[model samples]
Target chain A: MAKKRIVTTTLNGNQTEFLCEPRQTLLEVLRDNMDLTGTKEGCSNGNCGACTVILNGRPVDSCLVLAVEAEGATVRTIEGVATAAGLDPIQKAFLEGAALQCGICTPGFIMQSEWFLSQNPKPTEDEIRFNLAGNLCRCTGYDKIVRAVQDAATTWQDHYMKNCHEKGCH
Target chain B: MRDFEYEAPTTLAAAIELVAKHNGSARCLAGGTDLIDQVRVGRLTPDVLIDVKKIAELNVLEHGATGLRLGAAVPCYQVYGHCGIVSDYAALADSCRIIGGVQIQSRASVGGNLCNSGPAADSTPSLIVLGAVAVIAGPKGRREVAVEDFCTGPGKNVLQPSELLVELKFPARAANSGSHYRRFIPRNEMDIAVVGVGASVVLNDAKDKFVSARIALGAVAPTPLFAKAVGDALAGQPINDETIAKAATAARAIAVPIDDMRGTKEFRLHITGVLTERVLKAAVARARGEHVDCRIGH
Candidate 1:
């Protein structure tokens, strides 16, 4: 084992610190060191986005990122999607739409979707499909996954609009 | 994966010194989309990983009167998303847009793609057609290499062990000039290109004749090849189907394709001509101030 270095990052809105080897990937650090296993590892390479996580507001394959690279970065993983109140709307949409068969790729799909929606709240169906191209699902054939993202986008838009109205924000 | 020492130097000089110290046992880390994968597969066992993302000079993306100065570490997404790059350098933008799925683009850098030296790298042909120049920094100071000559062979480049690519510089887009890139793939998204063609043309004042042209092909050879014959055939020629067909034939003649799993040599050769014609036509249209989607053939 090489020397384990301390990495400080903001994970899921919480300032966190953990010890990891330099060779360990961000996915490994999130799962093993931080106990945030929601970010699954599928290909372990960049081909599959099952290990997708939002780093500094951009969705990237955590498997391709070194653990030390996440130092001083803001990381949002699958475990960060749902709040203390309840499941995030995207997660809820995935469940309601039955978007997963094995569920191995769900967390990645949800994370990418969240980042996509954050950038474009009212994305078209084509945009949704293109945005989710990195993620792979052996089951469900992606129709349900696409539908789930659409559902989530619509629901989230309505929720955001309502909150803005309450806050007197146009 | 082998454990390696990691150093993120904020200055290019420091990074160069680190690599010099490690000799050939250190690898510069940019986005790590490619390097980390190689490390995980045991293909690379660098004694030290010099993370260059923290180096400010290597992460710049500037568009000025001279042209575009793309930092070596600028992510593919940033390159594609930059309005100036997308508008002025359409061929490069098309290549960046299709480099990988969105997540890969978020971290993959064009410089990394070039340095990776994959024969089928999507960005190489476009960069070559755009006449991009790579700025390399090393213990010996800095040097510039034309993008077309950067890759020596598959998975090989001319970079010294102690050197790092600092940035890529593209010439200013000339008036009445347009560029286009197209690739044949088994799938629409997230697949290696079977045959890639990038074409750029500068039309005469009337926009009916080609004043100058450049054609570059990828995936059909050990390294991305500039189709000089094709460009020479189109120079000062009337921009018509006849000239386009002749240029395509020249492209096919020069293609040295291999029988790869993605495509047969014959298939790649055939598509090289086909894509060359299509890309040239699109480039001509773009040069005529028309908006053309280069990915239409995908």
Candidate 2:
């Protein structure tokens, strides 16, 4: 067998490092090696979005990515989206909008929605539907999920601008 | 899965050497969407994986007199958004756009899709219609093959074990020429095609008669099939509803769809008729320098 390789990256926001087998997937490293089980695995294939995570500012399936490919990159999972104080505004909106029934597909939806809102502060229903096509939610049927995204977009924009204003980011 | 050594080569020559040295026990890795799955399922057991993603020369999309040159590592998402290619060859762009979702598109490479050699591959028809050519390099140096003849059967290609599909070359349409692609799927997104049709047409100066035509069909044969009879039906003729209907009939007659979970043979043949008619009309409209208001969703 080949020697295990070291993979260095910023996880959530903190700098972290680990030694992983060359064949180890990002999903396996996160769940097994790092004990970050928040990143769930629904299907080993890329079909289910349950293993979605942000890699270098873009959302990708953790189950499909090799750990070595993520070297010198930044990663954010469902647990990373929140702060020490409370949930991210998107999560809060999901709570307010009741976007979860079984809650299995919620994390992936939230991560995807966060990435979507970053790209377009405000997106039309069609745009949201198209962008979120990667994610599948059986219990919600995407009605409440769509509403949650819209609600989160509005609220997050307001909150972001307010923070920028207070910090004089003009 | 068996343990394997991984090498990220910086140059195409280095990649080729690694592939050559490892020979039968080696495989080139690009996006890893398919490669990783096959490895996990115990379908492929390689002693070494040569990741070509680091080779800068294998990631370009260039246009030239011979044709459009797409490097092996160029991601599908990159191809889909390239305005130059999309405006000139929407068939290729449309094929890239509908391959899986954003994540898959971002990670899937055109070369990987072709090398995987699945019968239902969405990009095959687009390349077939554009008269695309495959550029392959190996221990024996390089050679080119028309995309139509690249594959021999399911999950099998004519590529040698030491060879890599380095790039794809497709001719740009001349004046009064245009190409269009259409596919039928059960869902609006994240679904494979039941049947896909791509057609290119060259119109005479008067825009009343077709000077030449080429039609390609996918998912109905072991490899992407060229409907030469259908192309013959439309060539040197004015494209009217009646002419298009005749071409559609010819296309259906040439196709041989198989029964599968995604579609029955009858349904695939039926949809092939509908899509061929739709794309042929769209190609004619494009050849006349008119914009197509794409009505189909997903």
Candidate 3:
């Protein structure tokens, strides 16, 4: 058998390393090897954004990426969305808006939304719908989810501008 | 997906050697969006997965005196995000944005799309109309294939097992020329194109007549087609609804669509005409300096 290689990456703002086979995807490494189960796996393929992660500032379906490809790259999962202080503004908005139901898709939604809102800051409803189309939510019917992202766009800009000052929340 | 030995060679010579060593058992990994999916579904099972992104030649995206040289591994987001491509290669920009959502676009490369050779691929038709050339590298050296003639059938192309696509080369934009790509899908996003059309038009100085034109159709044949008949019909034609309609009819005649879950043969045939007309009008408007969103053809 071929030896497993260690992939070194700045994961969730910290330097992390793990040994993984080339066959294992970044999704499997994060969940099975690292035990960061916060990033759920809905569909193992790229169709569901359940394994969404920000790789070098762009959101990607981690399941589509090989674990070995994460070498020397930066990645952010749902675990990186919040600090020790409290829930992120987007998470608060999700809570207030009841944006989730079964919750399997929430992590992916949060990761995707955080990256998107950070990019747009204030996106139109159409833009939000268009951007978040990749992250599928079987529950909530998407009304509250869309509303939550809209609210985050409006509400997070103040907190974002005050703290990060255009460096971006993520 | 089955286990496969991985190799990431940083140089073109080294990558070619590895591929040649593995022969038909090796597959080059560009964006891996399509390749990975196909592997998971057992469509392809390679003994060696060669990561070609580390190769400097395959990652180059530059517009210089010669033309636009797009690395085979250049992702869709970068193609759509490029100012040069957005303004000059509008068809490519339009096609890139429609590949998948931002995540897929973030990782999916147009070269990978062409190499996948799917008839439903959204980027192939645009590449065809843009007069892009596929640069392939093998153990024997390199060769160039016109993008229009790249594909042989669904999920098949001209490249041999050891050959890797280095990049796509597009000629300098023609004067007074504009291009656009659009597709019809069941939904707005995250769906394969049911019918797609890409059109580029070079208008006369007054912008009232067609100096020349190129049209390509997707999901309507065994491979994406360069609509030679349509382009020939539009050359020297007056820019009008009738001319566009005539081009549309010609496009439909050249299309050999098949029935599928995405659309019926009749439905695809009708859409071929409808999209051809719409895309040509959009291209004409762009040639006249109109701000047509690459996404407007939806």
DockQ of 1: 0.76
Tens digit of lDDT per residue, candidate 1, span A17-87? Answer: 99989999999888887788888999988887999999987899999999989899999888877789999
> How well is each residue in A80-130 modelled by candidate 2, as lDDT tens digits?
988988999989989999999988888888998887777676778877887
Record all residue pairs in model 2 with backbone atoms less than 3 Å apart, i.e. clashing. none
Model 1, B1-298: lDDT tens digits are 7889999999988998998888899998998988999998899889889998988888999997899999999999999888898888999999998888999999999999999999999999999999999999889899999999999999999999888899999999999999999899988789999999999999999999998999999998899999877797788899889999989888999999999689999999999999999999989988898878544333
lDDT of candidate 3 over A102-131, digit per residue (tens): 999999999888888777777888889888
DockQ of candidate 2 relative to the true structure: 0.57
Candidate number with greatest DockQ: 1
Docking quality level of the chain pair in candidate 2: medium
Instruction: Give the Å error, residue B259, model 3.
Output: 0.7
Candidate 1 TM-score versus the reference: 0.96
Tens digit of per-residue lDDT, candidate 3, span B1-298: 6888888999999999999899899899988888887788888999889999998898899986677999999999999889899888899999888787888888999999999999989999899898999999999999999999999998999999888899999999888999999999988788999999999999999999999999999999999999987897888989999999999998999899999889999999999999999899999999999988654323
Model 1 ranges off by over 4 Å: A159-170, B294-298
- lDDT of prediction 1: 0.90
